[model samples]
Target chain A: MALVRVISSDGAAFLVSQRLAKRSGKLKTEIETFRKSSDNSEAQPEIRIVTIRAEILRLVLQWLQQHQNDPVLPANQNEQDGRGDAEMGQSQWDRDFLAPMDLGIVMELILAANHLEVKGLLDITCKLVESKITGRTVDEIRTAFKLKSDFKGNEEEQTRLENRWCVEN
Target chain B: MDLNGTSKEVEEEVSQHYVSPPVTPEIAPTPPPPHLSGETCWDNLPPEVQEMVVEKLGDKPKLLRYRLVSSSWKKTVDMILERQFLSVWTEWEPFEQYPYKMNMHDYYDYICGYDELEDDDRNPTTGVILARAIIAGVPRLRPIWSHFAEHDRKANLIPSFDHHLPAVHNPKLGSPIPSNCLRIRFNDKIWPEIKRFERSRRAKTLADFVVKYDHCFSYLRALLLTDIEISPSNLATILGKLTNLRALTLEDTLLHVEPETQEENAVLPLHSNLSHLRIISTNSSASQLILKAYHEQVISLETNCWVPLFSKPYGNLKRLKLITNLKPDAQFRQGEENPFPALKYLSIIIHEGHVFEWDELSRTIDACPRTLINLYLDIEPRWETEEDKIRQLAMSQVTIPNVKTLGIFLPTIPQHAECLRRLILPKFPSVQQINLISGSWGCRSAIHGKSENETEVYDREEVIRRLNAAKIVAKNVERMVLELQFYATVCPKLEYIVII
Candidate 1:
């Protein structure tokens, strides 16, 4: 397998297998285009630097490395997977993986995963965020995320009035 | 001298009066615009990019926050959020009991009311108020209308929320309505127009209202109708308008009309894009109407009624799940003659009232046995007797020639293990997978008497022996799923065994 050097936005470089690296669709496309455009056969190409910031890219790479050998989940599998036995209980690995991250970092990672088309990472991050939000009060969410109370006086009052119907008894 | 002084003073006073301007109160200096801080406003992002972000957010709670970001973002969020929530809610919520009562008025009020409002306004105080109003208002409206509105009309409104609402409330106008005011303003703008056409007048009954609101039912892909009573004409009329529907569920609802009337009113044509159909019916005739429709339109059928077994078999079905009290008969037809050539999964529940005659079931299996992948048989123990022994023997003899997965549910402990022993050791030769689910009463003795270790050992050995024999008979057996209630006494030692 040919080795590909991936440089994150912070200028840190990591060598990964081309096959594994191709899991990130953006990188695959970039390399493919680069290969197609190059004319010199002996050209020692500079390492490809993906522009995603270093921290986000690191998390993405870590996830890709861990799930390198797992089955390639279909694009629509997130919707179709439902609540299978494998997903019913929290896996300890997933718990530890997500434990250290804050919501903002998790959100950024979700965006990164989506941009990279990393389905497993996107799913886990989305589910992690979903788990946090599911039963929480709006106030709790605001406090957790440090959201400002942007509603002007009665505007906030009216929203609660409207949301009242769907709130769980 | 005094006169001259007076004249000078007069001149000075006149000059002062001429130069004086109207006195105005000093205004407090306006505060400088509050610093625009934190993340960039979601609206400032390009529209296409915002859409991409919303798409990435999919239908999750992230979208909820996106809506609260700003008036423009709220519009985008509301557009997507309403449709997604309604679609999933319409399909799943009706059949299953919710932890809290879901009143349509309250739901509607909440969606309509909160959707426009700013996030801050929806506080505990207003939440209580709105909740009370929804709880009080929804119960008064008949249940049928609520169910009908949920499925047929809500989906069509998705596009309106997504496309129309944003256009009308262009955030670029600068003076954006706060989230709290948006919903009220939007409703003020639209609902009165809808109501003015005497739309509310036509909505005296649930069916009548849904029909009248047909203009709004176009975008729906999935619909759930539970405990709603509809006449054949009304049902057809309502169904006909929902052309974009993909999944349809009719649960515990009564369809009271003649078969001929139903045939005339059958709105779902053979080419309708419906893929999945689940009908849990208590009425036999109604079940038949639904099955007839299934035969005509659906690719997958799940029924909790036994009428299909007696009715002419359907041809287009790709999956069939039956839960009923009907007995199997020897002459029961199978396949396209009983047509299920495309069938992949078959699950049947067998109880005292619904036992399939042994020979009938065998013959049914023998016919249309091709393309069948998964089969589940559930037996109620109360009816298991000596008479059932002959039936069990017939079942053992029947060839499942191509079955890949098999599940058997037993209601209680067997009085005699002879039939099971005979059946397990060398029956159903082509089986690759097996699941045995035993009832609570059946495994009680084994659970109560033995130490946990002894229990585990005995169960494991028994399962291994049975499976080993099965492996010998059915050379392709590779996986088995065993679910026992209270009995840790028998475990299966298959290579891929899952104990539940």
Candidate 2:
């Protein structure tokens, strides 16, 4: 099979099959653009994703390879379903793929998947982040996200009080 | 090798295995990524990603916490909640006013331990609670009870109201629930205020709610109001204030003035931008008469009263739901002009014993033959023999050319089945979705003297067989929503069966 070169932000280059490279919409577009500009020759296309680091890029590529044969969902899949990604069911394998990653890596992977236009990966990663935030208190979420609470005395108390109705049992 | 490292180490192993195809060997478990510092957290993610994260949270309580996460997070979540009202009971309160004063006797009978049932043993579903509350002369409870009853019918059992009700009140309700059942922390003061109705600061009126959540009204797309206390002019004023409101639901609410009475009527140019209006009032059709200015803009309308539809032409109406009895008005002027030129979704729900209008319904359907996309007939015919004659005559005059969905919520007895095959299916040859819902009175077997459990199974099989035998010849049925008790196995291209 024909090969393609994928270069990550941190200067890591991996030789991937053309089929695998086509899984990433960004990579696929890049390859298509290259082929169009280069007269559709047999020469391999090199794709450099500047925003995604080597490790994150590698994880994204792994996900793409695993789901290489899966049917492509429409761009307006969420619109068609009339629901957001949180409600979409992911496969057991996809769940397992994301289960081990720490929150930091998961967030990074979400960014990478987003940059690569991998809807499935982006959806699952977002769902994971949502799972972490759901049922958690504001303080707990703040801790998880390492967010510095910006509200002071009265403002903070008011925000808390306003939101207290939602969590009240 | 360090026990804890960045994800880079983990990827190195994965890449090596991918590059060089390895023999079937158990892979070494990589060490977990080191604890992430405050370098990259949720806030640092792109705003679109943040929105996606929030969308995935789904539950209002979690979204509420996220709204206070940070300024940026608050902005994103606020936008979402504005467009979609996230408050569980904000638009749909269970009672107009609390059932405290009116039925102290029933309330006492249930909550004051008249039956001597332990609070833990009294695990009534929201349906039962709402039913009891409605029976106790609470007018506001009817709408809420209807909502829960529909849910109960869909679930085929009383769905636990555990999520909406205050869980800590084990004194009168079923099972002692954990305080965090609704995911909100109950303030020590508010709990007593909600139950006791004593000296405390709590939302007692819709006006109070409007003041508290004033920010939501500006961008609110939909609002369902059933509180009778709010007058028509007050509602009109409130509707006028909601700048971006698109859908409005008025249930059993009254409006005093008529729109035709231009001189005295204050609500003349109502929410003209409203695309959807739902009126579930059985007693008062005044609210429907008040919103005549919106006829040109309303794309969807659901009402029990037929006056709103028959009174004048609604040229832009794309959907119409007749929940109440649609009696043919004697004054409805017959004309060659077609109103509802863009009408697509038509749902006529005739309850038991209500007379079904054959000629008027057929005329309505004939008007939108090419435009109608979905036809739902939720009718419990007064008499099967009479319905057959009416169906044949009515259906002969109409044909929905572009209809893709056909939902029939009627008894699937042989006679009705024959009528469906003869009258309904052929008229909608383009239908790809068929939702065979059982009538509100449960399956046909209930009337045919079958065991309760066996009824559902028999009905499901009967429906499939009858539908298949009807032989409409429409290929690739995609969706079939049946009663909650039954699962569909007949459709060829069935993606999923909605159990409701």
Which residue pairs clash in candidate 2? A167-B183, A167-B184, A167-B185, A168-B184, A168-B185, B122-B174, B123-B174
TM-score of 1: 0.53
What CA root-mean-square deviation does each model show from the true structure? 22.2, 13.6
- For residue B401, model 1's alpha carbon misses the true position, in angstroms, by 3.7
Q: CA lDDT of B499 in candidate 2?
A: 13
Q: Model 1: runs farther than 4 Å from truth?
A: A5-108, A115-165, B1-204, B215-222, B258-271, B282-285, B306-316, B329-338, B353-361, B380-398, B409-418, B424-427, B430-432, B440-500
lDDT tens digits by residue: candidate 1, A47-160 = 444435555666777676555545566665546665522253235776787899877677667666777767667667767765665555656655555555566544444333
For chain B alone, what TM-score does every candidate structure achieve against the true structure? 0.51, 0.54
User: Across residues B376-425, which tens digit of lDDT does each residue of candidate 1 receive?
Assistant: 65643333456555345635355555565565543223322333334431
- The local distance difference test score of each candidate is 0.45, 0.51
Name the top DockQ candidate: 2
B394: Cα error in model 1, Å: 5.5
lDDT of 2 by residue, A1-169 (tens): 5677777655567777766676677877888898899865898887877676667777887887676555666678787768664346478888888888878888888888888888878888888887887788878888887778775544444545434323332
